[model samples]
Target: MNEALHVVCPHCDAVNRIPSARQGAGPKCGQCHRALFAGEPLELTTANFRRHLERNDIPFLVDFWAPWCGPCKMMAPQFRQAAGDLEPTVRLAKVNTEAEPGLGQQFGIRSIPTLALFRGGREVARQAGAMGAADIVRWTRGQV
Candidate 1:
């Protein structure tokens, strides 16, 4: 029997149970009826960050960034591209530290573009720098 995975919807933040085999088959959110993986990084805020971090059965990669930081701005495109390359299997998201300062403080994000990878509600790996799309994918894959 195939295992079931808990996937939080990017559109409505609803939790959906997806069978492992059908994850790549373009699953939709049960509540919102929207595509689960939209080939882009989900914008996470204080309201929904904890839910996604604790609920997703798959690995979650979060890019902690701020608007005015030059490195964060430079890495935004790379992170977006990495989301496309890593989605469905891995959930990619971005948290703007300027807007969600509390979350930044909670996570102890000292850098502007820190990449944190979480699995099963805990951090598995962390990278404190900007990276290209390939490196992001490679590093994340290596971690999980």
Candidate 2:
């Protein structure tokens, strides 16, 4: 039997149980009927952050950024590209420190464009700086 994986919906924050073998077959959220992996990074706020972090069976990579930071703005596209390359296996998300300062403070994000990888609800790797899409994919894959 294929193992079931818990995936949190990027659209509705619904928890969907997906078969491991069917994850790459275009799964949709049970509650919202939206594609679970849309090849885009989810914008995370405090309200849905913990659910995505703890409930997802796959590893989660969060880009902690702010709008005013030039590096963060530059890396935004790369991060989005990384999302397209990494999704369905690894979940990619972003937290704007300017909007969610508490999350930044809670995670000890001292730098913008920090990439933090979490597995089993715990941070397993952290990288601080702007990186290309390939580098992001490589680093995330290496960590998980």
Candidate 3:
């Protein structure tokens, strides 16, 4: 089913292989020997986002935000804190709409802070507006 994944280490950014069967048991990087799943929000660029979404079997909560938006800026630190708390269980990521206009347009992102939960490259749920860390955690509870 092409379920195998190559997860990028957040610590050293090294790539590691994760068998699909072991997704919930936890996975680790071969090079740095750290958990391959950082369990927090990882930065995704235009170049790597697609690959990451395609490969990782874990559920993803992605923030589609912009640098210029006031709410987006305000939500950034809360999102980061939430990421740190959720790490390794629910994969968190951020997509900067201003930096990736093509992706934003593709996702039909009309707001500054839109979030989507993805599994196997398909989105199952989405939300918009700035959110507190507690709300973020609650919203993502069943998503993963």
Candidate 4:
């Protein structure tokens, strides 16, 4: 029997079971009928952060950022490109610290453009600073 993996839908926040072999085959959400991996970072809010962290079986890379931070703004596109390169295997997301101060505090994010990697509902690795897409991909691959 093929193993199934739990994937949280970025659009609707619903969890779905996907065949492990078909993870890269572009699965759609059963609840919202939207593509599971959109090749872009999902905007994580206080309301859905825990769900995404706990539900996804794959590694979750969250960029803890703020709108007013220049480095965060500069890293946005690189992070987005990294998402395209890492999706279906690693789920990339962004948390705006300005909007979700509690989450920032919970994660102890003292700086903007911090990258936190979570697996099995817990943080495994983190890096603070801005990096290019290749660097992000390389770092994530090494860690996970």
lDDT of 1 by residue, 62-129 (tens): 99999999999999999999989998899999999999999999999998799999999999999999
Report the backbone clash tally of model 1. Answer: 0
Per-residue C-alpha lDDT of model 2 across residues 3-108, encoded as one tens digit per residue: 9999999999999999999999999999999999999999999999999999999999999999999999999999999999999999999999999999999999
lDDT of each: 0.95, 0.96, 0.80, 0.96
Candidate 4 C-alpha lDDT tens digits along 43-122: 99999999999999999999999999998999999999999999989999999999999999999998888999999999
Segments of candidate 3 deviating more than 4 angstroms: 1-6, 11-15, 18-27, 31-35
Query: CA lDDT of 29 in candidate 4?
Result: 95
Query: Comparing 2 and 3 by TM-score, which wins?
Result: 2
TM-score of 4: 0.98
lDDT of 3 by residue, 6-43 (tens): 66666665667777767556677789887776546778
The runs of at least 3 residues in candidate 2 whose Cα sits more than 4 Å from the true structure, single-residue gaps closed, are none
Candidate 1's TM-score: 0.98
Name model 4 segments beyond 4 Å from true.
none
Clashing pairs in 4: none
Note each model's CA RMSD in angstroms.
0.6, 0.6, 3.5, 0.6
lDDT minimum window of 10 residues, candidate 3:
2-11
Error of 1 at 75 (Å): 0.6
Winner of 2 and 3 under lDDT = 2
**Local error of candidate 1 at residue 28 (angstroms):** 0.4
- Provide the lowest-lDDT 10-residue window in model 2: 109-118
Candidate 2 TM-score over all chains jointly: 0.99
